[model samples]
Target: MAGKTINPTRMELTRLKAKQKTALRGHKLLKDKRDGLMKQFMQEVRRTRQLRKRVEEGLAQANAAFTVASAVMSPEMLEQALMAPRLSTEVTVDQRNIMSIAVPVFHRAEQEAQPDLACYGFAQTSGELDDALQALNRVYSDLLELAQAEKTVQLLAQDIERTRRRVNALEYVVIPENQRNIRYITMKLEENERGNTTRLMKVKDMVLQDAHHYKS
Candidate 1:
């Protein structure tokens, strides 16, 4: 939109045309990248939704069983039963690339094969406690799956946002600006060419008039 900064010449027009071509190519590539990221992001979002629902339902069941157990058992007995944990889980953190974004992956490290939750004697503890422990164990893998899906969704969201911005920049700003510049340069070059041709024609007319007068 600003005034042209360079001299109006064929070379300048040529350079601007080349730049426009390159900008168009870059814009197309960015659009494709944005589309791909969107597809991946949508898939992750769906997976996260499903995993969250499953985890929530599992947690609710476990909590209800725990409440029943707490009410059924004597305070001292409940406290004693829960005083120690029977299972220890270790999680390993790593990263995997998705759509050029690094997403965290969590996996349980090597551990004793699914140990029993018999931290307290069954005679002292209510059956509700056993039910609650069983419910928790059943959902353990689902909880891990939910965590992985949520983290993946987060990373994909960030990547999609970044890609969208880039696409917008190329589509709305860079490519258009290059095109405008190219048009401006071409118009100026054509105007200058017409002016030079007019001046040359006027010079020829003057030369011809002078030669006719000398002959007379």
Candidate 2:
């Protein structure tokens, strides 16, 4: 099946060789990119894990504090105290390219700064409410970071899979097929050259015989 559609000529051989060279180079580059992406993905996974643990712990503490506050305060008072928030945060999303993959970057684009998490008068809100709000505030940054890290890991993994497929195609399919075609073309060209040489020799021998007969 090799070189079935290819012309058995020097030109075709040269073209196949060039294509094979390019494929080999591309295969190497894709492999490198895959390796780099895998490394970045692992690092992001570790960071995400740590961020998740911290966020979970912070959330737990916040929940416990809220429970304690809820038990002591009347339902109406608790709802009224949290009616208005002092701090507001806005996140801006951008992208950064990693090995040709665009991964998300999150920034706190706009946020209102507050001296403390307390939005209500100290007289009305219990101390446990303050503790709960503080805990939620502390975890906010980590929660955003975890989101970014997890998203980056997902993008990297997808790119790595694509790169791996390309590498495999070039390594196991494209390059090998090109090599086989080149070999087939080369062999055919050599066989044609030998056949031409033999025919020329036969013609020469016939001419000599005719000259000898004419001389006799």
Extract clashing residue pairs from model 2: none
Residue-wise C-alpha lDDT for candidate 2, range 118-186, written one tens digit per residue: 778889778999999989888888888889999998888888888899999998999999989989998
Q: Give the TM-score of candidate 2.
A: 0.91
Candidate with the greatest lDDT versus the true structure: 2
Candidate 2 whole-model C-alpha lDDT, 0 to 1: 0.88
TM-score of each: 0.88, 0.91
Error of 2 at 84 (Å): 0.6
| Model 1 lDDT, full chain set | 0.81
Best by TM-score: 2
Model 1 C-alpha lDDT per residue in residues 1-216, reported as the tens digit of each score = 424476556887788778778878887887887788888888988988988888889889999999999899888898899777777779888989886788888887535443566678888788889988888888888888888888888777787788788878878887777677777777877788899999999888889889886432
State each model's CA lDDT, in order: 0.81, 0.88
